[model samples]
Target: MAPLHSKSHTSLGSRKSSIFNFIQQPPQPDVYYVGVDVGTGSARACIIDTNGIILGLSERPITRHELKANFITQNSTEIWNAICYCVKNCIRESGVDPEDVFGIGFDATCSLVAINEKTDEPMAVGPDFTDHKENIILWMDHRSVDETIEINSSGDKSLKYVGGQMSIEMELPKMKWLKHNMPGGINSCKFYDLADFLTHKATGSEARSYCSTVCKQGLVPPGVDGSTTGWSKEFLLSLDLEELVEDDFRRLGGIPDKNGTFLSAGDIVGKLTAKSAEELGLSTECIVGSGVIDAYAGWIGTVAGKVDNPTVSNKLDSKNNGTILTSCGRLAAVAGTSTCHIAMTKEPCFVQGVWGPYKDVMAKDYWLAEGGQSCTGALLAHVLAIHPASNELSHLAEASNLSKFDYLNLILENLVVDNKSRSVVSLAKHMFFYGDFHGNRSPIADPKMRASIIGQSMDSSVNDLAIQYFGACEFIAQQTRQIVEEMEKGGHEIDCIFMSGGQCRNGLLMRLLADCTGLPIVIPRYIDAAVVFGSAILGAVAAEEAVQEHIHKKGKSRRSSILETQRSQTSLNKVGSGVQLGDGQHSPYTAPTATASTTNMATLAYASTQTGSHHQFPTMTPMTEETDYFNQPPQKKPFSDEDDSEDEQTLSFGSKSNVQKGLSQKLGNLSLKPLTKTTDTSPGAKLWKVMEKMTGPGKVILPSDENHPDRKLLNAKYKIFLEQCYKQQEYRDLVDGVEAENIKG
Candidate 1:
């Protein structure tokens, strides 16, 4: 019952400095941005200046109702109110004039929100359709499994973009579920992705973000799915959800003659409505930028972060014609309730069981592949909650003035020291956990997959709970490794992971992830608030565009026009002159010379090979290795080998075949080496300037030494991690086989 001790006890607190400390000193009269992020449990808002330093932040928790198992719903009205409260509080905290905040951006979960088109009031989507407040179908809700399966059975080509089938969580399936279950169907209602809904609430604009529609609503970007229109109308009709396609998909943000004006992330939606402005304690002059799904916001906030490590930065910085191409090697893993693994590629890489290969979702002219685990943080919480010793652990943690995770981590570290183990990885060497409790979202995209525990006992003690927690953390790391390998197979050569959200604070999870995957993890400066900062970045981009428009309309010099329009706004200070304006005129703002057209030839060649390919990749054969590990029982000292010399060994789990070798080789070839070119005075160049100034660097967690004994331990555990996945399938097959025989008899 003694207070546990570890070096990591103060690590999280020390790293989590106040955002105010990083704010620009002696606040200038510059335009500000309010970034609002509506997460699963809370609505958070932050105020950031032109330099992208967060000045103030506030958060308010929203209520969610789990009416039934896997039937989660929330009140849209409550969410909006929480957002408004957070925004107002953040503004008050920052002491910035409301008039000075020129732009606002919102990002939320990819949940579905329903409202009556006529009344503009919430409409219920839950079991009791009368209570209109419970209108939102949470992104994690799995009530539409049957509908999802039905839609997938149509064999629609649109399904290909969503990893061969639609998820139960997407809008279409939820819509279908609502259509079948709701009393009057969906004719009286309009649906919005949560992010789009927030923008609509703020600006009264029906504009949808490409980030929301392309990623969730199955709107394949134009030209990718061979459709002139973004929507697949034929696919909709096949599913008997033609109401969505009616009026040019009016309910889903499609305009009549104009089709739908799906703006890319950061595109200006409109100025805030008077009502919204008053409610949020802001001015109507605040332009609303198009919103992105929360994970994509994490991508925006983290991928462009400056790398402080020269060796890593030099390796990642492959610039062709002054364009920064470091994003290709960086995968943004936005880990919170669930973890979304997003990687950008020059061309669409169709990895089976991974969502996307969708264009223009997060960045311009780039394809994004999204893989995820449906539950990570939630899974860890579940593990703790269900265990018998959880209460004792909690009491001890509280007594020591530490969080449950910190307490558990301290216990783990102490165990390593006391047992003289190699590292924390060896703590759970006897116990392996497969955390697919909520379902697997990537590689093997099965929703029915259940969790497995290889070596659990009836030991109801706090020490047992800590080891279980360690195993759960190991599960998260191993799954990440699997997801990365799957992405690599699909043609992405990810060398580092840029992480955001609450999980970034978990030093144990971060270290495990790096060691498990053998990839350096870059932690953003804002940590928990990175997604909101990304939303703030959107606001900055929108503000820049809005300023340019004002200048062009006024027909005055750019600087004078901006100053007059913004009242006290100064010219962009970081990059001066040689920047392209919105109307093809040169501006005082400077940016990189890399134009969108200045792409690497090697990248182009790689895309050429995958031009018409579906989810096909080169056949990868298994690695040739001794089967001794699988043949023997689990070892207590997996790291204790006579060959444990400090010789560097690459800790790879899967095949070392030609395909694996080719992935690394192809990635190297695709490195965008610098090419000298004339300065690009294009409109896109100016946007790049905004991005460079706004995106800042953060603390970096390098992968554990490759020669460390823990590397071998993790590599071995990862194999057990993968084997358990197949073991679950084998168990399922056994049960299914007996059921089939019984039914036949």
Candidate 2:
């Protein structure tokens, strides 16, 4: 291993041919991976083959305890149960043998899960009216707004990682809120980000993922006082929130808890304990991989194919000079209710209001920076729903047997003139909008700043609504443009856009984003609904790590060091009755040795000593280099007439992918292929020679009126109007309040 700190800085110096730490060779055909993704509203599971294909998928709605839209919470126990239900269903539906499954991975929203270690139960962070077991602090909750203001006032250096300002939505401010508001909740065991909690629940591993800790929890950055990694007690003390480390860093992170140690995204945490195997309906042998935040998972899943080779090749280039991909420079926009603008660069670039420069949080070795709109799809729906044209448009959609969004797109198509440069941009130019109704998450970390709409008309016609929708799309695109500019200013060479999440479905939004940003948008087909697959990637990686550990021991299959580490303190006598997933058998928590269900003096002494004065922080493995393909060009896969499959000729909604029941056709054929359109089939189809002039798959309409004077005027005038919004007295008060709070305290 190349030492701990070397892992943090991935892009430096010339080196020899070495295996990329994160890369995994294709496993045996029998091996499979299970991935679980717990988003804000749902828990989804996917069973995948070694070839990066989804074989089966299942999902269940996750319940949230809401005091309002801003105070969202969830039950830890319930989330786990939901995951179990989904995992079992996906595995059963996929018809894969339980013994074939070798690994599993997880990704969850960056919510906080407060639990009582003494009882192994969740504790409350909210009012008493509801169940205390609903102990999660949802990522969207804003109850800690005041606390965030207070922390930002401290002006700590840690704030730089979070864009020089902390949002109420982040963990530290929420930690402050919990400490002050719910005093009883402070006497805790472990406070886990939802993702890490899932890993702990599954494998009894006490390690946290680098994704959640560095990105969400404001962990002390690399090289702080020669520490390898963990919370910064100094920074925590600076905020007067020292309770996070009351237990020798146990609550924040101590040796006592199995999850207290931190693991980078691909590390193996441990094997599934018998209890977790029973709940998940998988074998106890299933290796549990370290988890990640949902958005980061999406980033990995979307860009991995572009950055790394997915095929099984044993060629010279595959080792020393594999495809060096430039996928890192491409920004991934996970657009749904909110849109996260995620970018990666070779080194740290801190842009105020944009959170990160987090080292290797997502892409390996590269620093990740994030910016976002507090609202996107949500804001669009909010304004449109109130318009009078909404009902009429809905009725038209229903009458046409199409969805409202589809109907709206059709209406937009009619509004455009053939061969005119005036696409949706022409109609929306008259109206300008700034979306921060839910508070800006990035490029301006101002939660107090509300949204502004400068253009509206008395006309409530359907066309008006459609035009407004177009304008919102344009405005959101403009916001994205501004974020890109700030990132460029901060030294990230971002040009191409990688889109993911639900918003990628909107063809119009995709086109406008490309035009506004003057960048090509690469929408990986699987990236849109990819959180679960990303988790599976992590699982495969963990299994790879375990394989290496075994190899180092000269091919011993004895329990992995990580697994032995977790159960090392527990005596063999404590083996409780456990359910076995395979062949419907029964067993104990561990089959390591004989069982009598008794504890000895040595066990107690060991546990205490590990957590007491003599305790030592877990040593991290030296950082391994991430796959070196992100800066390489995508291999040009030329299209050929022979590529058309006869089977695809009649693919439709009613068609069943599994009607043929081929293994490749399983789970509705979730493909990782790049989405492209046939250039000859468009409006320029007849003139094939002339159509070669077109390069992009999407019609950007930039050629039409390339230098329209109106576009310049709109851009300049809108810039001034935006300046005025921030310069207004109300905006100034919001800024002043942030300043006053920090200065006074």
Winning candidate number (TM-score)? 1
RMSD versus native structure for model 2 = 18.3
Candidate 1, residues 429-500: lDDT per residue as tens digits? Answer: 999899899778888998789898989988989879989988888899899999999899889999889887
Best by lDDT: 1
lDDT of 2 by residue, 1-745 (tens): 0011112112423211222222222223345678898878778787765545455677667687677657778888888888888788777766676545668989998899888878778888785424678799998787887888788888776777778877677787887888877855476646889999999999887777777877888774456324444566776787767777675567765532333676667567898898888788776667887898887776656643331111211221243211213344657777667778887776788798888878646434557788888778777777668789877876775666543444565565555533233444555565766666776666766666676766787988987887777767766777787788888898887756666654544556655565566655555434333567778777776665443444456434453443345456542211111111232221111111111011100011111111221112122222323322211111122212122121111111111112211222211111122111223322112111111111111111121132655345446645854674466546678889999999999
Clashes of each: 1, 15
In model 2, what lDDT does residue 577 have?
17
Model 2 CA deviation exceeding 4 Å by range: 1-28, 68-70, 183-185, 224-229, 255-260, 306-326, 363-365, 417-422, 545-745
Per-model TM values vs. the true structure: 0.78, 0.72
Instruction: Please state the error at residue 690 of candidate 2 in Å.
Output: 40
Which residue pairs does candidate 1 place in steric collision? Answer: 577-588
